[model samples]
Target: MDLRHLLAHEVAAGIIATGIEGAYDSVSCSTAGNYPSMGVSQWEGGRGDNLLSWIDGGRKFIGRTYSDIVNSGELDELRAALDSEQGRAAQLEILAADCLDYVDALMPYLNDSKCVIYAAMWCPTSTNVVRVFVRNRKSWGYDVNNLSALADVFADEYYKAAAVGAMYRQGYSNRAYNTYNYLVTHEIAWELLDA
Candidate 1:
């Protein structure tokens, strides 16, 4: 599966799981004793670090990819000709294509279970950006047939996470225990999953 697809699904799932009356960007808090979190996934690391990580990851990915293109002189000639509007447009087109290609290059390595963990750990915002961008693009009259497939995938992942959350909640109420105690008791569980 494409990384885009996986990311889209996760973002959608997160939106559905956390949405507040159609507000896709709604934020929430988690009371999970062992892993209290904020935002869509109840992500931890303090002060919404999870979301920041995702945004940072996107910036890094784009920067690294663009650097590669620039280093190869792939965009230099096009950039140099950008005095006229037409030339600027051509340069922008090349840049967009190069960026997409960079995204494509990451797809292969992202086709793994670790992608989910990585997102949960580092790139939740990147996926969220995809979701927002696709929706906005469609609203602006752009064809988003390709992203629709990823939206479907998002629905699937949402249900899966909901199920797991349900099951986890059933065994212990986060409200009843202190997060510190829960962390100690569930240390092994966290290690296994986070390992």
Candidate 2:
């Protein structure tokens, strides 16, 4: 894989982390749903367990459900574990790996740097949605090879989805729009792949 590709993934993930996770040490429980979520990507449930396990070989938060931790007032302990230097490093490593995996999955359908970054940003929440969008671009009257058009279409579709209360509230439209604007303003395409 291109080093630039990895950098693109990192940059996209950082943007998403800033919006959603707040900080690497941030943690939330049953805010969106019934499960505990933590770290940059907000890994939940089993994924949350996996993150904790990675931090200390499962010594801190393993074999405990969300309720178990909450009822026992262990959430602060969980936060402390995640706030450690080792925990921060684990979060970055896992997030990077996940982003790289998303990029690889998106490559066969969309190779544009902007589109790939957008897809990566969206994939963590709705993988099938983004994948289907890319796969069905042609049937949707979009030229799959037109990178710029594809990027616009992806952002527009994301905006519509956000408005529909499917993934997020209407306010989430700002995320899609702002993400696209950030990419364009930064000229990330030229900076990353020279496209």
Maximum-TM-score candidate: 2
Give one digit per residue, the lDDT tens place, for model 1 in 1-195: 444444444333333333311221222223433322322333333433423333422122222233353466544332323223443333233323323433343343333322232222212334444334444544656433433333333333333333455555532233112222322343122233323
Model 1 Cα displacement at 146 (Å)?
A: 2.9
Per-candidate TM-scores read 0.20, 0.73
Count of backbone collisions in candidate 1: 1
Please state the error at residue 54 of candidate 2 in Å: 2.1
* Clash pairs detected, candidate 1: 9-154
Off by over 4 Å in 2: 1-8, 30-35, 143-155, 159-169, 184-195
| Candidates' C-alpha lDDT | 0.33, 0.65
